[model samples]
Target: MLVYSFQGFSQERPLQQSKELPQRTDAPTNSQQPNNPNQDNNEKGRKTLEPRPISEYKIISVKNDTTHVDTALTIVKDYEFNYLRKDDLHLLPFTNVGQTYVTLSHTFNTTSLMPLFGARARHFNYYEVEDINYYHVPTPVTELYFRTVFEQGQNLEAFFTTNISPQVNIFIGYKGLRSLGKYQHILTSTGNFQVGFSVDTKNDRYHVKTHFTAQDLLNQENGGLSPQGVINYLGDDEEFDDRSALDVNFEDAENILDGRRFYLNQSYDIIKKNDSIQNNQITLGHVIDFTDKEYRYEQSSANEIFGEAFETTNLRDEVEFQEVNNQLSLTFSNAVLGRIGGLIGHADYNYGYQRVLIQESGTIPNRLIGDVFYTGATYNNTIGKLAIDGLAKINVSGDFDGNHIQGAISYPLSIGSISASVSTNSRRPNYNFLLYQSDYVEYNWFNDFDNVQTQRLAFDFKSKKYVDASLTFTTINNYTYFAANGIEVDQEGFENPVTFNIAKPTQYDEQVNYLKLKASKTFEYGVLGSSSDLIYQNVSSDDEVLNVPDIVVRSSLYYKDHWFDKALYLQTGFTAKYFTSYNGDGYDPILAEFYTQNQQEIEGFPIVDFFFNAKIKTARIYFKVENIPSLLFGNDNFVAPAQPFRDDVIRFGLQWNYFL
Candidate 1:
């Protein structure tokens, strides 16, 4: 498990290709990108970051290869299985979410405006997958583990305004929210997005305005897992494994699992105004928003154990869900007639919902599902001039929703510039899989297909100082896959009538493509600074998302400045990655027979990592030493621990601020 990465860090261009800075058009533009290395502002409103003082300073961002770039196409560990996996195994599972925003302003005498208060808190944590130890067969036990999740929310806002004479101003606000503490929200309420006003305008215009929003979150605690107790706890581990002559293929094998959650929301708005076009100013709006959801499921399993060595069944049953939405709008603007030009427009309406709760534990399991609520309409536009700008958007929802469109264009031509864009994207399906009900009961299969889609086409380019490029293509439809196995039979006349078990179902229709390149260069010779990246990936898994390695490549490098007089500031970096197989299609025969029961594909090696960053000023100190040339993985199934190959941290801090 030491798959590839000798050295070739070059891949960093992709923000929708915005035209790698030469000149090409698809129309839609505005330019302003760069600045924000650490956020700094001078003059009198002074602000700074990294020089310390943001509340005792302490911000550590770590992803250690972002879960191996989402599992570099299937397992590649062996520093003795990363020291024998287990510790919330996550070869790739994201979202350790975090959000913080606080604003307070009061200045009725400085500019004729005051009264604005804000508080926003968002927290997210998802850590599921407990007890999964598979040393590739042969009595390697470790099961019965599930129940690990957590989600949180809190929000409050207050508002006021003045300066009705400058163009026209008005404000009003009220928002309160709370969602207790739990892992996997089922329901939790608190809502608002209200704004009210009356207006009369200038600059050859007429206006009228109104707005509304309402949201709900109650009973949020849908922490799933009870499908017949996960199919009788994996059918008691296949009734105590130990089959004779080996020949297992119960449709890929998966005992039992479950999940469900619900939520609802509301909204409304109306507007009228006329300023016929020029730089651009037109408004005609009528919009509304609404949403609802509810889901549930139950399952069971059993069929062979001890006798022919383990056998069980239960896939899923118990489902319910709902959803709805509507909107209509038309807007055109000149960005308050700014330093040149800018314009925009919008229109909208859509609704959808579903319900399914096929249960059978304490009753209710007769299969009664429901669906019907697919509506559509949407449009957007933008225009700008000076540096340059152009943009457009279109959306059509219903019949599983999704009919997107995009356009962009930008040209700075001086202070070193370039931009480009092209788009057609759509990704939907996840209201908990259109209302859940999944099961496999250890080897007794069943399935219920839902509308699934992933359509994309993208191109981007940029050049402000250096260069950047990106390309993407995707196609996916009605994709749903599942596999499991476990079979055993026994009967010796008398009372033994018949009892054998196994399951099956593997869904598909997928295609993926990607190409990226990024570059950053700034060097006066010494104290140097350089950045580079290049990546390419391709995948076609009609076999269904598994060990997807279609192809991959990654790169990285960095150098820093200062040593003495400047007190001390140093930085260093190095990284490399590459993966291949798909079409040349390899691996994923049920995770290669659950790890080498056959079906090969795991021959790619070369791993490397190195890091160093130090600073001493305001007592700032940080030391890092990761995979300094170890490229681990020694087997034992792999899950982490090749001498911590990475994740070495040493930091100390100090910061002070003064303002009264």
Candidate 2:
């Protein structure tokens, strides 16, 4: 950390020139010579009595200096398990800790030519606990909680480029990143450890880029009970199921940590650059990524703890998955009648293969997937004074199949003071939505992230006026739903257990709707000026999307130039969330056993944050306060013992920059 303290700061004044900028002209000409000598009657080129009084014409020119506008430099770091409290979120640091980049631009012999360069670095640590709620019984029990995580990451990139002409330039860049992580957890008294490393590199140039990535992960588990192995103790008979007990006994023997590697390369180039006359363009892109994974697990138990020799259950298993993906896309467009935009078309093709093997049994499962998409659209900026825009897409894939179209028209009104437009669009399912696999495992873990349905249609209307107010209304249909399986089972007498199904996790076909309103205003009052923005979103879902809220509102306020020679500023904001219940048909089998009949509704939560800043010539300082009230909310969906309670922290930092 660095600190900077300064006093009596003076602002730098800009230098001025007496001469004015030269007038813009396509060609240089003699303005003093009139086309018609008789009309001007100034006696063109005629030397009169006293040297014509020697009229002065000063064509003022000044050298333009590079202004380092809005250059920012800062050090930021934080520890976060996940964004939005999700289990699948990968922890990354270094370049992810809200780093600030400083940019500098310079212009010489201006033919509208400018060059820029920038670099940044950031780092942090993250840890999380997993599988505490369900283990052999399908999930780890809260009583069996344990910590498992270690992560470190670093990323660096520097780029230099200059524009030869506006919208056309050449660039050179270098980028590199690395990630190392480790995790530890206990199942049936055995320790499970996982460690991994990843590295990535990228290079980019005009109209083309390339990327490469590699990763390796290792996992190990020991001292766990194995299936068909000796068992000494089991949990109380009340909450424990025999099958679950068997699972715990075999957890260690079934535990496997595998390593995975991935590589990707891609490029984009302009096959044809548009010209002034026809405005034609063609671009092509290609990408390929491959992955290989292998895992092994061994089972062990403490059979001789009490001196008596007991049976030993040893099980060994190994699994591997290999995947390769390739994609190619080509686009073409041509202007129409050299007026309204003509036609644009694109085609994309993709193929992928996945192979899985269970080493112990020599069993293999393989799958092949292919995809294609074709799209075309037309646009006209000026169709008899009415700006028009339209887009359409058709997709064909193993998991996705649909067509989407949208169109919009807008024209300036009331001397350009206000403009309004309405558009309608439709969407199909994502590539992952069509495939439904509840038992698929990834990265040697059984965690799942999936969606039920796809978006079918949407209509939106937007209105804006320079900057006073903005309003948007959208109606959506066939919205997807992701519901966790909710279940209930009788814990009493063995025979005929009565099961009450709660919420079946399914992508229910429903109409989801939302409306957004935003307004902002600028006032030049106390201290220099102030700006405020308010936004609201209303959402309705057919089924409870776990932790997502139905209504959200955000508001922010800022006060500046109040102290320290106009160097200090303050910002404050608050967010409010409201949720609704899930509406589905029945209880899902996967969730039926983990939940109780009486489901509790989660209450809304409000969060507030405050920030203050001070700027100096070579340094900047800032202080931030988050979760001011420290409110604790509860949720039963998470595997952790406690929902993320209110978090309160204060942070202050300073940054300095200098060039050599």
Supply the TM-score for candidate 2: 0.45
Worst 10 residues of 2 by lDDT: 112-121
TM-score of 1: 0.23
Question: Candidate 2 regions off by >4 Å?
Answer: 1-365, 383-386, 396-400, 412-428, 436-478, 487-505, 520-524, 528-551, 562-598, 617-620, 631-642, 653-660
What is the per-residue lDDT of model 2 for residues 356-450, given as tens digits with 9 covering 90 to 100?
Answer: 43535344333324333433344435555566655544444334344555455666555343344444433433222222221212111111223
Candidate 2 yields a Cα-based lDDT of 0.30
RMSD of 1: 25.9
| TM-score for all models, in order of appearance | 0.23, 0.45
**Model 1 C-alpha lDDT per residue in residues 447-488, reported as the tens digit of each score:** 344444444444445554555555555555554333333233
